[model samples]
Target chain A: GIQVEQSPPDLILQEGANSTLRCNFSDSVNNLQWFHQNPWGQLINLFYIPSGTKQNGRLSATTVATERYSLLYISSSQTTDSGVYFCAGTLQGAQKLVFGQGTRLTINP
Target chain B: EAGVVQSPRYKIIEKKQPVAFWCNPISGHNTLYWYLQNLGQGPELLIRYENEEAVDDSQLPKDRFSAERLKGVDSTLKIQPAELGDSAVYLCASSPGGGADTQYFGPGTRLTVL
Candidate 1:
């Protein structure tokens, strides 16, 4: 089983601000994904970066396998971006993913 | 893609009652998963299926929980004699089968056991 820890349990920022959320895993994982649980409770897959960097519009993520950590960057955040951001990872040879608590983000209009 | 489809967006039942949640995974997806999410917490895996076989279910509470993936397409999770503590959001997700594939989730079914 792999353990995951998310930093800054809660964050509040004004619209158009930028923020970085981090996720640290106890060991190297075969799969790492970032998800956004919107206000409607829909879990939206944001990124699947096992390693290296990937960008999806204003949302980008970078994972360092050697360091066993990942960072998610949100630029020009909007009120609609407010939600719980979670990072989960599946260990080598494992089928299930262990999840981190989450980072609660609130973007004020 | 239509993503994962789940039935009964919400459910409310008395303790000891039986309730079931249905899930239809994305077409062609061979791996399906069920997760439990408590309030203010991330989702936790309850069971996983690779096609029609249950690959991982050690985390499922067999005493009251049971899940099945018939014909390798749709899934059903049932809880018999539900308890008050059984209240939570049950989420269904699907992947393309590779161990490293990304999983997509449904909106989830919110259950409230009185």
Candidate 2:
């Protein structure tokens, strides 16, 4: 089984700030995704970047498959951005994904 | 397109009681997955179904946990004689069945055991 580790287990930021969360995997992965679990416990799909980069509004993510790592950026963060961010990965031919602990982000007004 | 659907959204039961959670995946999806998420932690895969057949369930606690994806669309996860440690949020996700296909998740069901 592959291991996934997320950096900065917990983060606190004031509104309008910026931050970066990172995820590192132990091996190459065929699938990689970043998910935001809101306070209400809904997992929202943020990105499906197995490789390359993608951006959605104030959120951006980049995955370097060869290096087995991914980075997520939040710029000009808002109060709504407070949640737990998780990075999940699955290796080729594997049916299940391994998840990192998560980065708990708290954005204050 | 609707995302995954899970019910009853929350549950509470005493130890040794039997409980079940249901999930309906996104339309046209061929892969459904069940995951368990503890407080302040990421989800861990419990089982994965590839259209009526479970291809991965190694992580499931077979002693008290059972899951089925009947007809390949709806899934049910059951825990008989549940214990306190079984309390967690159960999440359901669906994918289009590809190597890197995007997975859509539903609002998980929070279970509490007393």
Candidate 3:
């Protein structure tokens, strides 16, 4: 079983600020995806970046597979951005998509 | 297109009672998964189905947990005589087929055991 660790277990930020979240895994990954669990308890897909970088709106993510780490960036955050962010990965097979403990983010207006 | 659909957004029952959750994956998805998520923790895979076959259920507790994906479209997970520890969120996800692909998750069923 692979171990996924997310840094900054909890975070608080003023609206319009910037933040970065990181995730580290113990082994190689076949795929990696970033998700946001909203207040309504919906897992919203943020990015499906297995490697390199991809950006959508004020958010972006990068995964360096060789280093077994991924970074998520949020710029000019808003109150709507407050949620739990999770990074999940699969091994060679899709049978498992291990997730990190999650980074809880709170943005104040 | 609709995302994953799950019924009974929340359920509360006494210990030892049997509970079931249902999930309908995307119209074309061939792979389905069930995961259990504890409070303040990440989700753990319970089982995975490739079409109508149960491919991996190593993490599923066979004694009380059983799941089926009949006809390869919809699935149901049953937990009989559930314990207090079974109180958690049950999440269902699906991908187009299998292997490394993005998974779309349904709004989970929150189970409360008393």
Candidate 4:
């Protein structure tokens, strides 16, 4: 089983600030995903970046597969972004995913 | 189109009681998954179904947990005589078959085993 570690166990910021969350895995992975668990307990898919970079709205993510690390960027954060962010991944053909502890974010107005 | 649908937003029961949760995946989706998330933790895969067949369930605790996806559209998870440690949020997600596509998740069912 692979290991995933997320940095900045908790973060608090103003509504308009920006922040970056990181995830590091112990091995090469064929699938990597970032998810946001909202206050209502819905696990929303944020990104499925096994490698390279992707952007959606004010959020973006980059995965350096060779380095076994990934980064999620939240620009101009909003109140709705307050939640626990998790990163999960799996090796090729491995059906089970290894997840990081998660980073809890709180955005205040 | 509707996303994944799960029933019983919250449930509280005794440690030895039996509990079940239901999930309906998105229309036309062929892959279904069940995950467990403890408080302040990430979701961990418990089972994965491709159509009517369970392709992966290595992480599922077979002693008291069982799941079924009949007819490939809807699924159910059952935990009999659950333990206090079984308290967690159960999440259901669905995705199109094959490829590295995104998965859609439903609002999880929170269970509290006393």
Task: Give the winner by lDDT.
Answer: 1
Cα lDDT of model 1 by residue, A55-97, tens digit:
9999999999999999999999999999999999999888688
| Model 4 misplaced stretches (Cα beyond 4 Å) | none
lDDT of 1 by residue, B1-114 (tens): 788999989999999999999999999999999999999899999999999999899999999999999999999999998999999999999999757478999999999999
TM-score of 2: 0.96
C-alpha lDDT values of all predictions: 0.95, 0.91, 0.93, 0.91
On residues B5-107, what C-alpha lDDT tens digit does candidate 4 reach at each position?
A: 9998999999999999999999999999999989888888899999999888988999999999999999999999889999999999999984336788999
Q: Residue A66 deviation, candidate 2, in Å?
A: 2.1
* Model 1, docking class: high
Clashes of 4: 0
Top-TM-score candidate index = 1
Rate residue B50 of model 4 by lDDT: 90
DockQ of candidate 2 relative to the true structure: 0.74
Clashing residue pairs in candidate 1 are none
- lDDT tens string, model 2, A1-109? 8989999999999999999999999988877999898989888889988899999999999999989899999999999999999999888787577889999999999
**TM-score: the better of candidates 1 and 2:** 1
Each candidate: how many clashes? 0, 0, 0, 0
Residue ranges of candidate 2 with Cα displaced over 4 Å: B98-100
Candidate number that wins on TM-score, 1 or 4:
1
Give the Å error, residue B58, model 4.
1.2
Worst 10 residues of 4 chain B by lDDT: B95-104
